[model samples]
Target: MSRSKWTNIIFLIVILLLIIPQTRLPIQVALHKLITKVNSIRVLEEDNSVRITDTNWQLKSEKGLLKNLNQSEGKVIVINFWATWCAPCIAEMPSLQSLYDAYNNKVDFLFITTDDFKKVSYFKNKNEYSFPVYQPYSQPPNVLMTKSIPRTVVINAEGEIVIDESGAVDWFSEKVQSELNKLLK
Candidate 1:
């Protein structure tokens, strides 16, 4: 077959695959994962960074306990807003889990989602991820507000939003580790 014919055939196959829900999801997740593998989260410059004016946000733990963000004041915090149905969120979860494994003790990691705890728990168990997940009990601070899922924000001990990313990224990258270490010190 000619190159153009082969290209047209491949394009048609992709289109047909996307028309089916079952096949579409996996393809979308795979594409998202590929994007994340190549992309590293970028830290905002000091001037461009936003400061959290309030730490009074409330979060409900997976265990049904209410926790205050104020408790993490003066500590490095990783807050990810994601949903179980979000393909990009699912794609980046493994990297987030790896990052959590390495920094859970030293940093505050909050995998915030709007999904019911039951569903979130099922997803976590199925993926064998042990990261702490929470539901927002109240409105998050304005600086942390986002209109999209899979948004992640990293706040330093000094309360500066150093990293605010709105899509999937390799959370376990060397740059992320270095940034977290710097924030810790």
Candidate 2:
């Protein structure tokens, strides 16, 4: 082959090498499978500690008294702090709702929204979600002052803050259910 033809062939080969991985369905599937496997392995190696604290704080729920959270004695209270703008928060809400339905009487599922009361009302009205929605004023209650959406604070029946994590977590996970069961007992 002439030098120019050879160069053109090499360029085409390089382009194919780069484009094939992105364009090929099998390659994408394999990559997704690998990622899933890696994530599962990491989760298996995670610690199972239920982080809790005695921090005294309050939050403003549309339902009035913040003390209502304290009233759910002897029940597992899953306090999920989220906002409408957060995609993960919106994604995990349905799962949270399902979990709530499963344990409605056994657990107190409080879905707290940190967005403006107007926005929260609009979103809740639009979605027709029956979960208790709350909005903290300019100065949120101490318990919810963290200002981080998608933070879930699991509290035991005794009103003690259990697992306080700042991210979207699978509320219906076996691990979480198991922990809640322990507290219920």
Candidate 3:
């Protein structure tokens, strides 16, 4: 077969794979993980960043505990808005898990989702992720609200948003670690 013909065949195969539900999810997640390798998450400048002044946010933990966002005030927080069915969110879970493992004691990590608690608990256990998962019990402040999944915001102790990134990201990357370390200090 000619090279062009081979390319066409490969493209057709990919299209077919994407059309299949079971195969499509994993393929999309893999593609997103690949994308994160090249896409770096940056910290925003102080003047350009938004302060999280409203701490009235309410969330329920996976363990059935009601938690208030105000509890994290004066502490570094990594808040991620994600859903169980989101491919990009699944893709970034490993990196987020790794980050949580390293900073759990020093930083407050909130993995917020609108999905059912049962499904979220199952997913967390299946993936062996130890990060705390929460469902928004009440509306969050405007700064914490997003239309998309896998939206992550890192806020320093002073309540300023340092890194607000959407979509998939390698949370365990050195650049992210360096930024978090700076915030911790």
lDDT of 3 by residue, 108-159 (tens): 9999998998898899899998888999999999898899888999999999
- Clashes per candidate, residues 3 or more apart or on different chains: 0, 0, 0
Expressed as tens digits, the lDDT of each residue in 10-76 for candidate 2 is 9887668658854444344344334323331112112553323333345577756564443455667
Score every model by TM-score: 0.96, 0.59, 0.98
Model 1's alpha-carbon lDDT is 0.93
Q: Residue 9 deviation, candidate 3, in Å?
A: 1.0
- TM-score of predicted structure 3: 0.98
Please give the lDDT score at residue 96 for candidate 2: 72
Cα lDDT for residue 97, candidate 2 = 71
Cα misplacement distance, residue 152 of candidate 3 (Å): 0.3
User: Where in model 3 is the C-alpha error above 4 Å?
Assistant: none
Error of 2 at 50 (Å): 9.2
What overall lDDT, based on C-alpha atoms, would model 2 receive against the true structure? Answer: 0.62
Instruction: Write down the lDDT of every candidate, Cα atoms only.
Output: 0.93, 0.62, 0.94
Q: How would you encode candidate 1's per-residue C-alpha lDDT over 1-185 as one tens digit per residue?
A: 89999999999999999999999888999999999988888889999988888999999999999999999999999999999989999999999999999999999999999998889999999999999889999998888888998999999998999999988899999999999999999
